[model samples]
Target: MSFRRVIIGLLCLAGLAVVLDFGAAAYSEYRVSRLLRDGSDLGADPEVTFHGFPFVAQALDGQFRDIDIRARAVRPDIPGEILVEAGLIGVHAPLGDLVDGNVRKVPVDEVHALMRIEPVELGRLFKIPDLQVFGPPADKSDGSGGSGGTGVTTSGPIILTGTVSLTSDTNPVPGTSDSGKPVSVLADLRLDADGQIQIVATDIYYGDEATPAAMVPEVNRELVLAKFTRTIDTRDLPFGVRPMKVEASGGQIVVEGVGKNVTIDLDRLQQP
Candidate 1:
């Protein structure tokens, strides 16, 4: 072939390659938006959006937008498997997938709200936001939430070990002196497949207090501590069922992770 003809052919191929690349990216973006929108519809809510992505979703009943989340590696006084960042948003969700008989949902907004509060929020204080969960919510009957037999998988048994250095935004108590030092909190958390969470240790240091201090004083200090560790066990309990019983004594914390005791009523999902 003539040199000129060969050159012209090569240029045509390059142009086609460019078009294909852009086409592939557009397709990927379309697929992601569709999946997110489908998730929102299943949850019975508005829309879902993640930063530059155009689609919006109802993480729960709450609304969120311009969310930019990511996982990264860094060094300093921090150690983490990932770090997530987002613009102004409301109610992201805790990290477990929900499994209820034939139904499963993420409750992303619920998780977000939980993450914003105490103990859970402590992970962010360290700049190491390793807390994350993957996979779509699966049904317990389909048999995919956790291991084979226990029957609870919406909230798997998750164990989190981390250190938190936190400075509260709350005003100082009327009678207490301010140390002006960030407190260090050591935490170990567990959540069963049935959506129950148990907290083993959430030890914190505040001035002279040796044991962990209560985030809320109106609550029984011991119970408050136990609740953070215990109530999580009920987080994924049937939305209407009473939580499994508990007995607390001494300083030790014990809990039964969600098991066959939990039941899911998929019939509640009615179409309007």
Candidate 2:
């Protein structure tokens, strides 16, 4: 064979290899997405991306270095839809099961997921009108100069703003003579042991102005404070991931968690 012919043949082989690799990646993504959709019953299609080169080799080894799945507008048994992004690390699934469409269970070494809850949904959860949640401010060194004593300064407090309805029958807050009226409030957002979000009122002001607490009737102030001192259940998160942190920012709530050794079935992805 001529040297030029040999070079052309090698180039053709290289091109064929590239095409095969691309096909393998696409197939892998399809299989994973189908498996997740069948297992999770997600509302929309789940996007799956297999990391690393030569996806077929990873399939042969029955282990993947990383797999990312983004599920959009997932409607769980919660108040509203949430967007979930799951990162599956060290996923193990045999090639035979995947090919035969018998992938019953997938084991992952470490799983991290983020669920985004919009402000409208948060309002529903809090049962408040015109509710808006903001993300926590950046942590900063304590501005208070200590006496160089045993006290150490840390981060600042988290402040959140929202509106709450006050009623005479249920809660007769002092400032409003009307039975039911909307009151603006500033509260602190936190998570409890049962993975629920807690809202504790810090200050109650009139309208958008920072009115003095004394100006509002003491009885009404207490009632307003009591209205916001409640915990919201957020344990209905998907993928059985534990709720770790809750952040309110950009008129949305972001809940993050880590899942360890989660097992998902292929048959229940589309169910309610």
* Candidate No. with top TM-score: 2
Tell me the TM-score of each prediction against the true structure: 0.30, 0.70
| lDDT tens per residue, model 2, 1-272 | 69999999999998898789879888868876776776676665688888887777897899989888777654544477767777878888886786467767678787776777776776676666455443333334566332221122111233334545556566555434343444545567667789887777777644322222223456567766675566666654556667788765455656777878777544433224
Each model's total of backbone clashes? 19, 10
Q: What Cα-based lDDT does every candidate model obtain? A: 0.30, 0.62
Tens digits of per-residue lDDT, candidate 1, 1-272, equal: 69999999999997886676555434533443344324323332212234432222232323334332221212122232212111224323321111111233322221111111222232443232432211112236765553322121223322222222233467542112243222222334444456454444354323221222334333223422232233332332222233333222111122221222223222211111
Model 2 scores worst on lDDT over the 10 consecutive residues at 147-156
Q: Give the TM-score of candidate 1.
A: 0.30
Estimate the lDDT of model 1.
0.30
